[model samples]
Target: MNADRAETVAILALGWLASNDELGPVFLGSTGASAEDMRRGATDPAFLASVLEFLTMDDAWVTAFCDATGVGYDEPLRARYTLPGAEQVHWT
Candidate 1:
């Protein structure tokens, strides 16, 4: 992953962690279950695609959501949504 993608992934991981437990979103207004959703998303492309789709709409949460769901990364969990994409955010 490039710097931008890597950064995006880091923030997302934070957001994903925030989704867990009674904590306020990893970033804010976090929709609980990013972690669970990611877990389900993994080994389940359909679910992953759904999550990516869900994120595309939520500009504010994309970062935290990704942070909370750091499935394809190697970083310690810190409850805080981090992914915040620019206007050019998109999924494939």
Candidate 2:
């Protein structure tokens, strides 16, 4: 996934999160992000990637996000690879 695509997915996921009565507050509290921050972050690729990364942390969240956004379950994996500093660390 390219940065643009990943950012789009993240934005969509953020919208879903924000609309959920339970998860909305949890997401904001966990990330310490205000509504203002989310508005600002929507335009920031790195911030968007972080939002996706946060959602990918849990399988239930990933499933719910995917179902809500009409994306495949594997999208989060692809999005993670597109983010900055996502290079594999080969320690052999």
Candidate 3:
């Protein structure tokens, strides 16, 4: 759950999706993210977390991304929570 490592994995996952012509367009369209946004997000932990969250939205996409990047499917779940400000708040 290291934030640095999570950000790296998130970037790699985004790159994996971007490499696909079909999925790339879909991802960009769905996120409304341009190339500039992706570049900026590469250095932003919060934005990277959002990327991981976006990827986790689809089971099929998650499987494909994991297979392509050799990252475990559960990695995204761990990553999103690891990002700064992502901690769960529990009030009892």
Give a tens-digit lDDT track for model 2, residues 4-34.
7877787888788878898878879988999
Give the TM-score of each candidate: 0.33, 0.87, 0.84
- Candidate 3 lowest-lDDT run of ten: 13-22
Model 3 per-residue lDDT tens digits across residues 1-92: 68777988899977876677887787788889897887788888877887888888889988888888898878888888888767778998
**Per-candidate clashes, comma-separated:** 26, 0, 0
Error of 1 at 30 (Å): 14
Candidate 1 lDDT tens digits, 7-37: 4444454345435454334323444454555
Off by over 4 Å in 2: 89-92
TM-score of 1: 0.33
lDDT of each: 0.40, 0.82, 0.82
Give the runs in model 1 whose Cα sits over 4 Å from its true position. Answer: 1-38, 66-92
Give model 1's clash tally: 26
Q: Ten residues in a row with the worst lDDT in model 2?
A: 77-86
